[model samples]
Target: MTATRPLLDPAAARRRYVRVCVLFWLPLGLTIAPLVLLLTQRGLGLAAVAGLTAVHSLTAAALELPTGGLSDVLGRRAVLAAAGLLNLAALTLLALGTTPWPLALGMALMGAGRALSSGPAEAWYVDTVQVHGGPGADLRTGLARGSSATSAALAAGTLLGGALPWLLRLGPDLGAATSGRVLPLSVPLLLGAAVYVAFVLHALTALPEPPRPPATLRGVLRGVPGTVLDGLRLGGRDAVVRRVLLSAAAAGGALAALELLTPGRAAALTGASESGAVLFAGLACAGFVCAGLGSHLAPLTARVAGSGERAVLLALGAGACGLLLLGAAPTATGRFSVLLAATGYGLVYLGLGAAGPNQNDALHHRVSGAVRATALSVQSLALQLAGALAGLAVGLLPPGRLPWLLGGAALLSAALLWCRRAGHLAPPDVSSPAEAVRPGVRTDAGEGQRLL
Candidate 1:
């Protein structure tokens, strides 16, 4: 039997890979996300959170294709730096805003940072690995490691967000508080800035840079429309791409719905008191920690399931079940039972996160650098679109309907996964059709022929 090739230069791949991974996740975890909506000024009402998320998602969607192209044209290092700056600005805005309009704007700006950061980090890692080593290789090591780092950051961030609100670490409540001790809103926000700064400094010092010529302002603007269209076309044509997009959309939708609704769900599930606050914080940390674990375990789970598509379906199914349990957890055993809800949320996220990058890696083997960015951009578009619509829908629903709304999103996510392009598997190497379906594939049908 032939031993498979290494994914990239394992050592450089490991170092640069870990750096980029942490850079992408650390600041993101500390700022602009779960805390912004869930533990916001009003205790994260469903409609309010959903509305803010929708706006944030829309901003992300707006930048998805553009940022992907920027990575291709400008190089990943620059994009990563830009992303960090955008995040710092966004966190500042989010922290300062008390009302909806400013909050929405803050969310939107944060989403732009999210959009710019998304594909570039992985693309850089993959490109670095290829230059140092060879091609058509095993990517799971780097991918899994990166994912593990991200999960770690997320786990840490979840704990921080939960405790930061209640901690009396700050000097005094300038604005005043109900209790003698006070945790100002600026504390978490500033912490987020600190994390972003750390990530930026790390990136500059640790990661390797390659040659990249800058593009003119006119050239960049002209390329945007074509970039968006071409990416959509490429993704649409590829079987693996199709399945990845669906899986990503489903996962994105489910995640958006869960984050938007869960704070209120926890508040309602647990009574509103100091003890209740502790419980809610504990549950929030538990949910994210479990989610991170699910992300780390995704490769194994996908292997068992036989493909990314099936894995996504399984994850979405788990999420759907969790939503139901969360919705009904008002009984004697109800509060204890909602742990299942957190578990399902994590599993679904795992599926979504794993599928897209794996599929993009495969497609990169087929396409050249110029177009590769576009293909990945298309994947970003699909995920963002799904999240945006789901966020809007959840916000539009009446205040108390979040659980059902989340359940509906989970079902929709399942539907999208089930509709994956299952016929495109070509059984690379010696793998069987059954195996291909588990991993999912595109039969040169998309690119007309697989390239050397």
Candidate 2:
């Protein structure tokens, strides 16, 4: 038998993983602040923009499972590289495309890239850690650090992305030169594309996995569907997994309410759409900064709460309170209302950031490495689907506190899921060093190995 290659030391692996996380997320941050503004500048109406955003969400939701399965079957590095290439194309199209069709196509491609990239990097990190330190490895610290890096990247990108166009407009003829074919707003997207190139290179070179049996095309085609199905069934089979999925959906609903309604509130406060956009961008940047701080504090949160489950419960409860505060913001008048809104927004993000690492750490303890990426995809899918539903519902409701209240209610319910502990929440044994270290090996034989 061929000897298995030794894995990187845990500390070295973690540093590389954190670096990759920043690279993967920074480009996304660069585009987030300017994407809608750029699209509208190209003559797209609000409805058209909404349609385009829906296309991205639906495409990602549809592809999430299959792409995750592909990662499980093929490998993380290859899948991540593919996502980068697709995102590069997507960003290019968005930056330069003038017509609705091209832009729509770009959105679809971006969604596909989002789905493909979602889980693989985190899965790779967890697998590497467990292989080095056993199934009981200290995963929260690394996970929290990665989450912090992601938020920091996003915060920096949002500031840079929002400022680049304004800076371009200041120079004589600079706006005319860049804004004629490619608007100054599109510069961020172009920069994001360049970043994707770096992301692709780094993903290829930096993330190394243990050798697997050479996969034939037929094997991959056959394996992916099975893996996806197994992932889907995981929620039903495991109590802890079900709780995680449900909580993800609830969190999604809360976030959807915020994203859908917050801009209008900002506009209401500022009394102008343009200024509102600027204010929203600043708020968004601040939110990310708060989230990064929260993520950095996650390990400490877990330590204080006594268990991952308790930490998640407390964190999500805080998020629910934030949403409620937002719901109450409109009831106040003048600067007080703005203050309420801002505080609530920061709290919501902070709580969510803190909750995420603890929740995932609990999740990682329950599932095997073989299906790790697929599991994360399922969690993401739940969030996307629930957010879509929540957006629709919030849109139909009478304006004011109702929408925010609905989100607050959803988050509170999710937080309540962890109020009581179950026996199944305990971590499974993988004390055998070889078994714990083996990537892609099925650990749930008694549950039926036939699934693999």
Candidate 3:
């Protein structure tokens, strides 16, 4: 008789998840600081850059659900590896291409990669932990650690990405060899592509899942849409899930407003766009650091609040208060305004960071492993779509406290959604017979009914 491979313990699985999370996010971070500057250096105008960004957003939004469903049908390892490969190609094209078409294609590919990666890793982590520790696994600690790793990777990558070009210029003119086509700004993107190679390797080798039934093309085509439909129906059927989706949208809107308004505020304060850009970059790094700190503190927050539901409510309320403070910042006199704005900025990220793991822990408990990735994809899509709308509205609104106030109000309303006890919500229906009867599995029908 053939022996089966041993399943990983929850502790080992958590460490692996955190490592993969860092690897996955760090590459994207490496490109974030230098992408815009690289495009402009390659001769694209600001208008063109904006259009390309929109293309990325639209492509990701369009593909998010489909890719997530594909992950469900095809398995997490395959989809994640594919995403890494696509990102590698996208980064290469972005680094090398000077023309509009190549750049646009690169952005589209990047968006596709983003959609493909949205939820598989987290889903894999949850599934693995549950398999080892039963349905009552300590998911929040692992989730919090993963979140913290992501933020730390982004913060490190952003600083390294921003500093690489300047450091290169201090040494030698490497761009001369490529006749200025390979500008210093493009170096970060090239390095990002290299990172993706490692990411792909890690995904394929490290993330082993239980054997899925052999999937043919016809099977995949049929399965993906069904899974996607099931995920869409979840929000309508589950009250807790519905609330989570709404809260994600509100958070996205608040973030959109903050990102749209902050740079201009910084520029107005500094009297030069260039200096303001520098300050904004620094502030972005600080925000990520604050987010990491909050994520690290997530378990303690839950302990203090007495439950994950109350923790989310408190954290989001804090975020809403941060937005209100930002709105009030404009009214403050002199240097006090700067101090107030900075404090609010940190608070916004910190609150969001603390809320994310707790919110996701609730989500995982309420979802079956079969549709877990798809549910996460739905959450991501809600955030992206709401952010797009909020960005448009904030852009159109006249410069004042109205935009910030609106964001705060939306977040506050979302916070209030969690004010009621979890027992009041209806339990989610079981997704499948396999999930319902699986050994050591706790279906949402039992625990989800008790905890929101």
Candidate 4:
């Protein structure tokens, strides 16, 4: 039998939350890519950026199932501390090395750090928020807050990436060599290393970790397969989880394709002129700002989505339409298509951020620590795998031809989510409205008679 975890102390939750935002993730956004670009002088070229992203996603995919299990057995706070140290090591490497091999090594290490940090933080938040409200309506609200923090970090990081080097005049004056300007690239990583060290300290003394058995080599190997199996089982048994994962895979796949081919797509839209690249970058930046703003409005969008499942379905549906629009776009229509796609992306994230907690809280009600961690990792792995495949497919076709493929993928994603809701629209939990743990806990989906 699966026993639910108790809600933790609220004040502790707030401390951890604030620490994660300012210390860990924000610094990450500020650190890695821009500095690396300075060393490589690549200026957002496809191979360099895409390779970094692909390696990161692949590492996350490879580790997702096992890392979650590791957290389960070792404790979330310990793993997070280890992760902070690893992040420091990664940035340190980037500061000193510029070759593909060293940078690749650094990027891979960074991805490993991401694997360690991402899900655990969400798990921590879920555990913490459940304390005050019994995972009540506040669960979704908490996720919204997290999403807001992330968006804010992203916005700030993007600006810093553009501003930091020029602010220091570290560029051309640094004396460019055959390998480009090394000094400009070195600064961000060194600064980030210090920040990561702070994160390590915070994780150690500030965060509360539960007691667990000493980690064993044998247990880690045994736990991997077991945890993965548990995750598969949960998805197989639960219609909603299954839908979310499938939708995740499809959306992730499309997003991966977008990441790979967006430049080319933008160029094609803008008539492939000398200014096309700048236009594309600016336009995409604008779209990102819109997404950050959307995070602020997630509560309102949640209401618009009606119920959690419906919100997910609507997000998926909009993405499908956006994809088709891109595929069908012409000279005049392409601009409109990109705009729609951006809108779709922002709206979907809003729904996910708002409804994600509800789903997570439901899972907490359904399983134990190790199993819950494993389940979340399974979703992450599916997304990574989908993204990996989409990225690879980018090269199989001509650079400009990726729009249609993304469209088809989006359609498939929408259909899958719709099917998940068809089977089990779980009723809201009346017994513990405070800890609503049905399929989706936020909405008042009332009654045993919600009979699908």
> Which digits, one per residue and each the tens of the lDDT, describe model 1 over residues 1-452?
11133333566766677767765676566553345443355355777887776777678878888888777666676778888888887777666656567667777878888888777777767666656544445555567667767767766775665556556445556346534121364566767877788777766555564554557878777765665565666554555556556656666676667766766665555655555455555665556555555556556756887654465566556656555555544423274555655555454444444443344444555444554555566667776677768877877888664545565566555545554435443323311211112234446556322211
**1 or 3, which is superior by TM-score?**
3
Total colliding residue pairs, candidate 2 = 0
Better of 1 and 2 by lDDT: 2
Candidate 2 C-alpha error for residue 87, in Å: 0.7
Candidate 1 vs candidate 2, TM-score winner: 2
Whole-model lDDT per candidate = 0.60, 0.85, 0.85, 0.59
Worst ten in a row by lDDT for model 1: 429-438
Across 166-244, the per-residue lDDT of candidate 2 in tens digits comes to 8977766644765567778888999999999999998888788876668999999998998898788878877677889
TM-score for candidate 3, please give it: 0.94
TM-score of each: 0.74, 0.92, 0.94, 0.78
Task: Give lDDT tens digits, candidate 4, residues 173-232.
Answer: 543453443565466667778888888887766655444556687977776676666666
Candidate 1: stretches off by over 4 Å:
1-8, 32-55, 93-108, 169-183, 273-280, 305-321, 324-336, 339-368, 395-452
Q: How much does candidate 2 score in TM-score? A: 0.92
Ranking by lDDT: 3, 2, 1, 4
Ranking by TM-score: 3, 2, 4, 1
Clash pairs, model 1 backbone:
306-438, 307-438, 307-439
Off by over 4 Å in 4: 1-8, 11-15, 31-36, 42-55, 131-137, 170-172, 175-182, 213-225, 269-277, 280-284, 332-366, 398-402, 408-412, 419-452
Give the per-residue lDDT digits (tens) of candidate 3, residues 187-221.
Answer: 88889899888888888877777777889999999
